[model samples]
Target: MKKKQLSIIENLIWNSAGSFTYLICQWLLTWIIVVHSKDLGNAGNLALAISITNIFFNLACFNIRPYLVSDLKQCYRSEQYSAFRLFTCLASLILCLIYTCMFGYTMDQIICVMLYMVFKLGEAWVDLLHGFEQRKMRMDIGGISLFIRGILSVLSFMAGVRFSGSVNTGIIFMTVCTWSFIFLYDMPQARKFEKIAPVFTKETIKKMLIEFLPLTIGGVLSSLGPSLPRQFLEAEQGSKVLGIYSTVATPAVFVQVAATYVFNPVLTEFASLYQRGEKRRFLKLLFKISFFLLAVSGASLVGGAVLGQWGLTFLYGKRIGAHADLFLPVIIFTCLNAMSWFLWSILIIFRELKALLVINVIGVIMCILIMFPLISKYGMQGVNDTLILYTCVLLVLMAVLVGRDIKCKFDR
Candidate 1:
């Protein structure tokens, strides 16, 4: 029996529902910690753990999902990608542990960071499965898996924190529940479409590492670009303030998450269009997505301006709401960052890995040079200012790259 394939609209709907549910659950977890817990430092600790683990997560996944989906030529088998992913995930875990140990974090913070990394490690594994599902154009399956796992993880975390009153316990519950979903649900669903066993090959692994080295480095630097500012904020201002910033900035992140929901389902289409030399259709699709993202970003800015303080106060309490002045800059930062990533998808589709690396390297350098001074001077506002500046620089460079690539395609 042949399975009926979903239309693009169907795929988009599923992907958006799943991704939005998962992201909102994450946001809500932070909100739960803030509203229920007596100590604000718990939120701060979790925020710090997330900021640190995000970079490591990029390292573990090595930006491979996009590459996996865009491999229209099927240069490598799913097993090969799986093998490499396992290797990277293991290596990234070890590095994460070493980093947490070496950093001056206290024992509790170290435990918190390591626990969060465990959860992320599970996510990275499931992500590989999702990549396989996406390549089969069965994103609906992956979306369902994400929805289930997201719900289980959030509920478990909520229960754990409510009972134990510790963020670490909450993360432990989230990790266990999430991994259970992966083994019992995600892997089984993935196996229905393709083989889940990883086939190890020395030559293929080496080839992928070399080919993807630029992207791996670029991914780390891209994560670092935002993380450096948070690190500076925490250093200068303290965890409570960092927690407040994280809470305040949470709503702004919806803009970026929304952008991903729009573009991710169409990534395969982008590759197919470009590969088939349907340049006109490709450009039309690209412009349409970009315009939609801009429209959403504009709407978000307006909404933030109108009800930003009240919403923050309602969700996170008056302490966090007091910093509502940072709302606009945070929204602008997220919007610019989201647009930068939209351009990033184009570069990934074009396989402009070297250019991506160069752009990220310059962005990270700019971030380092300005982050400390800005955070030290303006405090939380300085952190937002630095991010805004960093993402602006990134957006401009990426636009130039995408433009040059498009012009060359048209000229030819």
Candidate 2:
């Protein structure tokens, strides 16, 4: 295919694959918790623990995952196949061990962490596969992987019709299967890296590791930023309210998930444009999309939520909608926040990665200051208010950073 044709296909694949994966993970987790636990308190506890595990897995992958994607893209173009695989395997093993004993971990936490880390290793290969797909712009196969995961997750739910262990086990099995396929998908493309393979050395690996820091720290802190408020709420208002809060958070979470899928390929393209020194296109796309992102994603959510707040019913079910009123501010901000991703997306593309690390730190700190006190007094609403406040702070900071980035170009 020609270059433009290839671009379209790749975007198609990347977006579709991401949507499939997000839906699978969302429904699977949602049902597993609902069916397994009886009360909101127990369900919220389980959700909280599982969420920490998910974050821990993300941290576990942080060491080299992003670097692997970035470097693997370069290696594929440069024909350094063997070296790429060697680095991938090395990075995977290192991550597996780091998660094993790294944190101030408990014995049980350690076991679950290990199970989760294994999941990350599998996921790392998936990233490598995505890197390959993006290199060739062959998104179809990547979409295939997501479809497979989604199918397995749905089957898991259906199997719960007859068997009790169906939910978690099916989810695990789906995770294992998805990663295994991704690893297989990556191996064939490793051939493209053959020529540059021998030049790969310790120095090269170290450089990649260093480059990984900005995104890794940002991803971790960014992951924790929204989460910490809920932790405060749990500590103060307790788990029942937290569960209700999380349930009502569905729309925001789902939209964010969809945004992520669309954002990934655009991010890769953005990074490439930056590398190619295409400043004008980057800024234009950044502004246009950022405006639309906020308008479309924020509007329906804020409005639907206001009505739902005053009313007593849920479009999905009353159970999950009970605490919808308490999270209105959160519902609105989360929409705005989802759109706000446009800033970080550009940051990723611009390679102003340290911006991510620094800003998310400020965001987390701000969340602590704003939410912790309010959480004890007002419950989930307090948590919601804190999120809104931090978002405003971050929004202004992002605007300043983006404006500076633009001005720097003119100065040059």
Candidate 3:
């Protein structure tokens, strides 16, 4: 039987469902850990641990997913990409182990961190599969896979945390769920598109890494910029404060993910339009997408301001709900972040990795300059302020980069 390719709307729906489920699972898992754990400190430590691990994971993956999907010229086979991903994942796990030890965490904290890293590793692998599916315009398969993983992992996590009251146990259960979904569903689906065979070559790997190094650096800095506030909070205010911030920030993830779900289906079209010299159409589409994102973000900010406290209280209990004031700034940051992310997608089409790296570096510098002082003055509210400032800087920098690239292209 011939497989049906997804239309743009169908693709968006599937991707949105998948992203929505992932966000829900993320929020639920944090809620479980924070609400049910014996020690409240565990919530903050777990959040910090995940933040650190994600940075290393980006290093390991070397920003390869976008590179893979944008390989419209078919320079490398799916198996080759898989091989590269495997190499990087192993490296990332080793780094996670080393980094975890340096943190001087307690035994249980170490165990939870390691288990979480393993879980993230599984997700990264599945992401590579998603890249293949996306390149084939079969993002529905990737979306379905994410939805399944999210549901199963959340269920297993809830049961584990409830039974043992241990974040480590929950993480282990979630890891198993992730790996199970990957091997059983994700791999087979990817295989249906292209045969699986390990292809490892030093030359190809080295060349790919060199070519994409700027993007990898940009990705690393991107993660670092957002995380600086959490790091500062953990050090200056301790884990409890950081945990509170993490909980409050969870809603923002939905905005970022929703933007991706809406805009990503058309990413490949951006490249195609530009390459074919359909400059008018490309610019028109870009403007429309940007405006749509701004409008959605505006709506979210207003809605969050009005209902955030009640909604968070309803979902995560009163403890988390108390920080209702943090919701507005966080939502504002989310809107800016969503717009910045959309701009990054446009820049990706132009292969503006170096410009992105410079922009990300500027954002990080802004974060460093403001995060400590704001946190020192305003406490948890200060961290949100830092992030908002960082997001604004990124939005402006990315916009400038996009404009410069477009000007250069048309002038040539």
lDDT of 1 by residue, 257-368 (tens): 8898888888989989988888899889999999999999999999999999999998888888998999989999999988998899889998999899999999999999
lDDT of 2 by residue, 1-412 (tens): 2333257446756656656575756555555565555666644653455455555445545533233333424543333333444465555456545644654444544454354455555655455555555555555555666666566545554454236543344445555665665556544543343232335766665665577567767776766767778766765666676667776665456555565566555555656656666778877766666665666566656666667654324333577656666655656676657655667656554467778788888988888777767877777777778778877777778778878876775347
lDDT of 3 by residue, 309-343 (tens): 99889877888899999988988888888888788
Ranking by TM-score: 1, 3, 2
Clashes of each: 0, 4, 0
- State TM-scores per candidate: 0.98, 0.78, 0.95
TM-score top scorer: 1
Worst 10 residues of 2 by lDDT: 63-72
- Flag the better candidate by TM-score, 1 or 3: 1
State each model's CA lDDT, in order: 0.89, 0.59, 0.82
Per-residue lDDT, model 3, residue 62, is 77
**Sorted on lDDT, highest at the top, how do the candidates line up?**
1, 3, 2
